[model samples]
Target: MSTTTTLEAPNTGTWDGGNEPMKASYGKLMMWFFLLSDAFTFGAFLIVYGLARHKHMPYTGKADDFTFSTEWWPIPEKVYNAFPGLHGMDLPLAFVALMTMILILSSVTMVLAVEAGNRMDKNDVQKWLLWTILFGATFLGCQAWEWTHFITGTEEGMLLADGTRIFGANLTMNQYGPPLFADLFFFITGFHGTHVLSGVVLLIMIFINTVNGVYHKRGHYEMVEKVGLYWHFVDLVWVFVFTFFYLI
Candidate 1:
């Protein structure tokens, strides 16, 4: 009798389609790529804004008494002093600070939802997702209010070089500092607000799916984790925007 010896295949130390690629699912990897591209877009916008800001002269007037002019950039504290339902009070960065806090709270709730998903606790996931949606909506509402105030401009208004007084901001003219400032503000903040709105819509859909047992039936909650990634990215971008636009 002749015996034949069998040889085992050698390990190549490479992904062979036997598990998730790079230890992450295809969906997750795609989401990351999309976010990376988005980050580049935001970065470009901010970089352009920075270049433009550097080309202008800085405001040297007192925050409370600064007058708008094309000769110099308006102080952020002076321009953003208005607060909702509290006129005649100089509350610089107050509303935006509240908006940032709300966004941060939403991120926290999203974390809770992701954790609940890990535990496969559908009820907890649903509860946390609902809170996250609520917070996102609140942030959007605050943004709308801020935009309205910015468009309406200040009651004092600004006197133009043409011997005419103007109030509020438009795409062409703004009562606050250089026209470029308003242009950048509208573009950047509006872009970020659009992202937040999209996030709120996605969260609502995710909440619905969770309520319908969609993820539960699938035996995994990866969908929640994916959206959580996006939510966190939005919150992080807002922090940068807040710093660049308001604080510094």
Candidate 2:
């Protein structure tokens, strides 16, 4: 007597990890994973910020006695009023709004670059990518100027009850309500600024490679698409930062 044996076929789905899931290449998928993890980091920072703000927010009562006080969370509009070349004009969010617009425009240019890449239009891709880099660099410069203004502070910062004379923002103190405000400001914006700077560098490198016909030689412009994903992520994160840090 002979025993009959049946052999099952091997699984051919993503469980085998043999195919490009979602039609994304390994590099693109990895870029996405990196962005997702980075998003969680930013989210945690923002969540902490929210909790701190809630915990430290000044108490309010009796509208008649309610007065603008340094004890409360610093009003973003009042804090960010100064615009470049407009000394003491009280512009109020103008510079920040401009920065936001600049970043958004750069995101748009990145979209165009990716679109041009899809067509394999090297010249157009180069043009759009260069514009994106310029905008990003300009935004960084603006942020540096803003940081300088913040650090230097006004001629005299708000006086405290103890009369300790808070000058500007540092790790230990802030002219604003709580030191944590400035701490989060520096950490969050500084982190985002670093990302922008890095994106600019990456754009420069990809620009050079695009000119050198690297992508053309490869018969595709997936490099531009990959970097574009990063660029777009940076821009999206800025929107959230702006909402939480500036608008809120």
Candidate 3:
């Protein structure tokens, strides 16, 4: 007697999006997807910036010797050489360096907040989150100052070919080098700044919730982790922006 056994159908429930992949929660996975998409957007913007900069050769001279010219790309150091208190000084990248430090420190505080969240320490979470917010606000203030200086420009100003004397950078003209430089600067930096602002708002929300014991009642701090991911991403993007837009 030959008995044939029938094979049962494979279980489809696990594959029906019912189970979390890689042991990650649905919310965490969704956050990753969103971040991946955002990365692509930022990557495209940076790539375009790189290609455009490559197409136009940057000035290969001293910052002091550099002149305003649309024909060639302006050196970043020459363009961003204004200091706050010490006006008229040729401190290239000083203010930007400070901004970078402030942002990085904010990222550090964010990490601490996430760690505290993971440990279920609500007090520490609130403390670190507040620090992160303060640092982020400081960074934004620095950026505002930088923008003001960039717009106000040097007292000497640049004389255009058409007998127009412009002080700083605007959409139509740039005292630095090419108008394209200023355009990309505003768009890219402005986009990043908006992200920072959003992150700060989110942090404030999380801080309020923590103070009110919302996450404590829920028994998990996953919300903090999600915002932490976003904060870290913003900080990481700035590093690249500083490298490409400033140092390069």
lDDT of each: 0.92, 0.88, 0.90
Q: Tens digit of lDDT per residue, candidate 2, span 1-248? A: 65987787766887786566489888998999999999999999999999988887653655344333557777777678899898978787899999999999999999999999999999999999999999999999999999999887776686878876667788778885678888999999999999999999999999999999999999999989999999999999999999999987
Indicate the TM-score of model 3. Answer: 0.91
lDDT of 1 by residue, 1-248 (tens): 65987787755565655554488889999999999999998998899889999999988766666788988988888888888999979898889889999999999999999999999999999999999999999999999999999999888789987899888898899899789999999999999999999999999999999999999999999999999999999999999999999988
TM-score of each: 0.91, 0.89, 0.91
Cα RMSD for candidates in order: 5.6, 6.5, 6.8
Q: Which stretches of candidate 3 lie over 4 Å from their true place?
A: 1-12, 61-64
Q: What range of 10 consecutive residues in model 1 has the weakest lDDT sum?
A: 12-21
Clash count per candidate: 0, 0, 0
Superior candidate under lDDT, 1 versus 3: 1
Ranking by lDDT: 1, 3, 2
1 or 2, greater by TM-score: 1
lDDT, residue 125, candidate 1: 100
Higher-ranked by TM-score: 2 or 3: 3
Off-target runs (Cα >4 Å) in candidate 1 are: 1-21, 61-65
Task: State residue 149's C-alpha deviation in candidate 3, in Å.
Answer: 0.9
Q: At residue 116, what lDDT does model 2 achieve?
A: 97
